[model samples]
Target: MAKNSGRSRTGRGASTEPARKPLWRRIVRGVLVWGAALSLLGAIFLGTAVFFTMRELPDYTTLMKSQTGQMIVVRDRDGRELVSLGPSYGKWLSYADIPPIMAKALVSVEDRRFYDHPGIDALGLARAVYVSLTTDRRARATSTITQQLARNIFLNNSRSWTRKAREAVLALALERKFGKDQILELYLNKVYFGGGAYGVDAASRKFFGHPGTELSTAEAAIIAGLVKAPSNYSPTADVEAAIGRGRVVLGLMVRENVISQSEADEIDFSKVTVAKEKGQDSVRYFTDWALPQLDMLLPENKEPIEVWTTLDRRMQDAATKAIDGNAPKGTQGALVSLDRDGAVLAMVGGTDYVNSNYNRATSALRQPGSAWKLFVYLAALEAGYKPDDRVVDEPVTIDGWSPKNDGRNFAGEIDVRTAFAYSKNTIAAQLGNEVGFGTVAAMARRFGITTQINTKPAMVLGTSEVRLVDMTRAFAAVSAGGTSVEPYGILKVTTTSGELLYEHKSAQGQVLVPRYVAAGITDLLQTAVATGTGRAAQIGRPVAGKTGTTSSNKDGWFLGFSSGITTGVWMGRDDARPVGGLSGGHAPARAFAQYMRVAVARRPVEPFDTELKLPDWQLEPDDEQLQGEPGEYSYYDENGNLVHPDGVPGQDELPRYEDGSVGPGPGPGGVPPGVPIAPDYGPPGAAPPAANRELLDRATGRSVDDPGLRPGQGAVIPVPRVTPIPRATLRPPAGQQP
Candidate 1:
């Protein structure tokens, strides 16, 4: 009692329990305790989430099947791999087959604890965070090999915290479900090394030009370096940077004891070879354009399919070379080539596919300038206007907008053929008005052009945006003698096991124009190529095509067909900026020449069924010698048979020649030179029309469209005699004029 009293008067005895803290401190303690409890609950919740996520995670089999389903391998007509739609891979390499040095290099540079971690790499991650903060070593500081594999196999290549969390959780699941060796093998076989290459095999072949089985240690080191930044460290993109990264990998290998320091030092990285850069890989453009069609051809989520396409490597390579060699700086080009049946043989969408993958051939909708004239002229011909008919090319205005010729003076009373050859905008505008702009748009649709076409007068000058492929197909219709065709790419699709999925069946073409109409258009195209803006595209053969230049020279095009191969070329800046001095008759035409020069030699396209003939007095007046004695002459072919552009010639009232040969006069194939004639002849052995009735134009000697007609009456409208070709020719020029 005395001792207690001696203590401070505040207390008699010491309390057995600890002293009470102040209110603020107690509140802080309570908060800390609650925080700890919540953290524990969060941990339990995370574990449960991991349990469910693991359940949902794809197994090895599912991973492989999903990848297989996404992959679409394309083969050219000759069965060589052209391009791949999804992740491209070579033969799969097992962990044992993977160079032991390759594994060590990746593990050393990517995750030192790869062999020991449960895929999450808790300690390695901590060290990595510490090293990233404290050191200057620029290496792969996050994501273990297993994590990378998980992200690549199951998730999109997107960067986000959610993605990372999923990757971490999935990595643990991978370790829990799969053996370390199995995971390593998958990672080795499923990693992306850029340039459309996936897996060690594809990376090996793409980078070193060798099989993965034959990779050297230095080469392996280079591949390991790409895991951090595939595009940045691409061997093709930057060899020096790749080698420097490879050196880092080798140093890491030395630290990991995967290789002796002496061995690492002795490695000759200088001898490391990378694949030569193909100037421009344009083949991918075709594949990308055709990939969407693949989905329509195959079942959804189907196993890997082998696509046999109509792509011709020779033509494709030639197109690429031409575009790359001729396209001006900062400009791009697109080319589309088709057969008479409209099979797409070659398509070059841009100058450098790596720089831009937007397919201009099938997708870019640039103004065509005068190339749009194909439809306008066709519409006029269908409306009873002959190629030799007179068309005014003087200044014209429609809807308060006047269109002028490119030159100071206009060829005022030019023949339709002349106006077409020269691509006269005034004449085209006049013709568009005469036939109705709607009809011109209909004509384009008739020829398989599906792009939206403006019905305004400027549309005649190609002011309406159009695609290269669609225009190419439009020309293909004329080349096919009036039969319309749709451009096609994939010829066949099959599974790897030879299971046929889809096979192409060509449908009978729908005739969109009369054979005479086609010949008339052909005549115009041929003359343009020979003497007009398309002259630069001349292939020393009968080529029917035209040149188009847009306003401000923004887009230039040369689209034509010779010997059955129709090609369309477009050159311009992507932002619609002017390509200085570029014209359809210039770079685009030159490219056409370069491509066709090689294309014609590959196969024999039948000469157009109709031989090019001299213009009439109402035609080609230049051929004056064709005018024979002033008496009516009957028609005869080179074989001495009477025929017209798709009909049997009138034989009942034919006048006889002095030689008693009926129509053996001085003109070509026996027609009087002075007498006006029409070069309308059907292909040999062509079956007559369903009615089987035949008629001839008395005024022009052309096959009339009817079975009956009065004397002096004519098929279409009567026009003065002028020299003319079998096809329409003659036009006088200017924007998207040439």
Candidate 2:
């Protein structure tokens, strides 16, 4: 019993020594604790920096809203929408609302395996890394869909390694904060499509005129491929590339088992279904019309809004095609068709919407040339100049500013019909002076030519610059028979949910002129095609038009209309340089005629709503038919009155003497004395005198005086003497010479 107690005390004594740990374990524990604490602090710093950055960002909503302004939706008379103008963006829909096929196609084409990745695909990152290490190229971006969305909404199309890094970080954050579906939805809604489309939905409707859900398999594939590069796959811009991209999308679908391989392989690449884009800027023009209404609806920084218009796609297409075919080569053109009530039917800004977005028809202010004279003549008619009133076409000058006729010749006494038919500048100038430049300027403004008129006599000749919209609108007033209609681009603006925002109304007012007076002017203009300078504008239907050619051949314009449409065409270089020797009648009219031929092919024939009455004037005898009066009887002396047979008093009497002076006054062909004699210094009266002394001497090869002679002969020139100088003396007899 004593030994057992001793052993127990010994075991207790052995436990008194502490247990030893390995040096490596102690080092690991200390390192892990310190590393964890530092990581936490670094994360806190990063979070704080991110928070401050977010706080300093500009308000996106406010920034976008301040830009909403006057929007116009252009449409045809049939209420078919052509273009949307202003800050118009299409409706936004959630990714859940998007078709499954659309989503699959997009994912397959843009980023396959999107669902399997966390913001970024590890495989894609690895591939990018491998490429960067082995290849001589810059590193490829390894961004996810969320990253693209963030960049599109808040950044530029910058291509930098730093930007790529930011995108990756933002993408991870975005994915963690928002659901995958929400991220995709924002991405689809925030991209830009060609032709001013803002989102996939808007793009679908714009290219195909159908909703996103209604897209065909091929159409959907084409659109989905565009998200990667819109211009590269734009059907209008790069058709071949778009087809190639469409094929690539189809192949991806087959590869992903989204569609049967057989079906994908059997797909016809040759037959791509591209819906015809109606007018050039239909949606943009409509947006242009609707922005003002949107401003009034929610004037503050407005969210991207939707607007519906009454532009007809077919009419818009026709108008666009017509303008493209008619506008001069290398020259931009614009067309705006409107109803009598000032509602725009179709509008085309330029031939290629992708190349130029300047909207020349509404925005470019060019001189209207003779197109403005319609108003001047209208004013004259209102001032009581009848169609048959006599107006002299003699050369005239007004206030030191002379206006020449289109051609150099002047027609003696023409009636107003012929005068207006010829676009006689002298007659128009006289009318402007008679009716006052202020009156003509006021009349032009009333008819919608609202640009500044010089109020000089030249303004009557259309020297003032005006926009195509204004010039056509002024002619439209004549087309509508005097009730001026303001040219407008918008019909109505609305929200995505069909809430009415605003509507457009024509500008109201009248510059007093009776309907009959305006009709009379229209009648005169019709004759412009029938027989005048605008004859080339004659269409199959009864047409009325005016040809306008600016000085120096700088601008050529044709503004005309059938019973249905009034269109204006201006052909000139953008730099305002002169064109290749063209007149308004030849190039501009031919282009206008060619376009109208195609545009009006399907349109029904309609006549102007005015009575056709022939005036009591007959065609005057042509120059060839009018015999010139005998030259002897026609000319007069300096007084300008007709000369009598008794002749010009002692100045120009024939050498026949009534009392028979010196052999019948030297006969019929005689040269008499005091006939304003030319000097002859060849020995006084030598050989009936060589009047042109130097010329005769030169012709005969006779010895002539040479200045090089020894101080004896005058200077000898090879050519005839122009004028003789008085002989100089070294010492002048001053007073006597003076």
Candidate 3:
């Protein structure tokens, strides 16, 4: 009876102790049960949400059919993009064309489970969720390559839960519709790689100057790193930061076993050469000039096409440097270079195209200044004026208008060759008068000067306005041995799909000037460069050109050519104001020389086709003249002054015939007959000698021998001794005036 009672008491005590358990234990058990219930409900909710998201998603076919904007690319002769017009859409590259390393690097860095996952990686998502829950931070991205592609192609970059859900659904759809390789190719060809580049192919070309198939491991890694944030990792914008990102990619590549550790280490990031972002604005000048001709070249309904131009990238760069380096501040300039066939190799329309889109090279109709003299001289050559034909360079008036030299100083008795070389305005004006202004204008038109020219005498000095391209084309005609050239920029235009739209078949034109005439003109121009105003433009090779400065120094020009290429450079104010007295010889000529040196560096040296031909008088007299022949001896000093063989009169002195005799005879000092001598001799206050007085009357057209002299005029007395007098003090005989 006692043992039974003890057992009952022990049992009662144990039950009472259990009923007195800690409060914390009961609270934890209740909370866990509630947490389990909530978790189960959340799972159901998520599953339902994903199902609805997938149902509402667009068809994969619809997504694939969506097209982006098209591009109109302008490639150089070598198929390099000089300028790309329209939207930035790169050419579609297939999976086979992309380098395998590029794909491996992208997968290693962007998504490690790219091939195994069906749009989403369950393990990656679980890891991301576990990390977020443990650290109490925002969830990290576990987006697979497929999900990122979906977000890129189908959805906007919004961080909302709805967008994320949509991205996952679209990614699953993409995986179901396309193979792994196809999706990757789509990603590569669709991703934005900054700097207006749209695809990996474009990005590769933009940053590496080559196609994706040629990418080295380092280059592939560099491009893969740009996927995260293109602008931040652009090699051209910040090379060091870009290289740092590239190293990270290479490290990731090694860890993923996509590349060996040794391979990553062997990569020299410093050796990677990033192609500079081409200045679209800089090449717009050429495009602007070339666009208008596209319609004429192709049919009206032509599709988007690629225009292959004649531009040589190297020459264009050289031309730009030449013009920008030499052009003065606050002034504008233009440069145009063309081949012998009239293919424009380089065209710089203005100094800064961003500041002004006005293409000065082809559009600006500024005065060509002395460049117009080319046609005038060309006309004179056609009119049978020998290069050595002498013309008086003294002051003259025509219709009460006078044209003065640059310094208002005249060079007396200059031949046509020397006159053109020295750019003597007076001689050009006289020749223009003699050849008829209409004839000169016609010659200019025939030489490819389409601009309207004023028939006035001032036109000989290039007062009329003309386009730089027109002048360049005209100069190209001379370089081509008188064949007219119509400057063209487009070489061919073809559709992106390889359909031929338009092709340039160089049209042959008639020869406006005779080949011999062009050659003769070329000879004179060569002399101009050797010893005349265009001396500054010599490029160590045979070059012929002209230098022209307009009145008031408003415009300056240097139009010249090599055997294969002809270029024209012009400098002046846009407002037609003086360019601070910058003459053609100072800046324009220098710029021409600078450009031609680099442009023709690869071409062989060539000389002018014709040799210089001088007149009989210009040749050195033979031994007979050395014997002091009465009427055959004459010589000119450096200053072009006529002197006796004995050298009595220096360059500063003038020889005068006595009594102003109009007949050819040997007078004192063996002075040649029909030559007028200085009448004003000795000091300013001194009187003329009796023989000099009669000679002065004959020179004034008052002698009986003078046709204009009075009918009853008596003949002069015996001839007086010849004397040397100062050239400045020598006056035209009384009846003779310049």
Q: Please provide TM-scores, in order, for all candidate models, with all chains considered together.
A: 0.61, 0.60, 0.65
lDDT (C-alpha, whole model) for all candidates = 0.77, 0.65, 0.77
Model 1: which ten-residue window has the lowest total lDDT?
688-697
lDDT of 1 at 284: 86
Using lDDT as the measure, name the better of candidate 2 and candidate 3.
Answer: 3
The better-scoring model by TM-score among 1 and 2 is 1
- Model 3 global lDDT (CA atoms, 0 to 1): 0.77
When 2 and 3 are scored with TM-score, the better candidate is: 3
For model 1 the local lDDT of residue 194 reads 83
lDDT for each residue of candidate 2 in 140-194, tens digit (9 for 90 to 100): 7546776677676656668887877666656665556566776676667656666
Each candidate's root-mean-square deviation in Å? 13.6, 19.2, 18.3
Clashes of each: 44, 38, 8
Candidate 3 lDDT, 1-738, residue by residue in tens: 445556554454545343556889878988999889999997787667656666765664454334355457899889987776654545567789888999999999999989998888988999888888899787786688889888877788898999887788778767766789988988887777777776787788788988777889989899999988999999999999899999999999999998898878889988999887777554789889987898787777423468899999898888988889988888888899999898889989989998998888988888777778898898877655667655778786654559888778998876788988988888788777665555566677778777666655577888778899999889899988888888898999887667788889988967877666788799888889999999999999999999988877888899999868999999888898877868898899999999999899999999888643433223224533454433334445334446553434543455444564333334566756444443434444332222234443343222223221111112222211222122333233345332
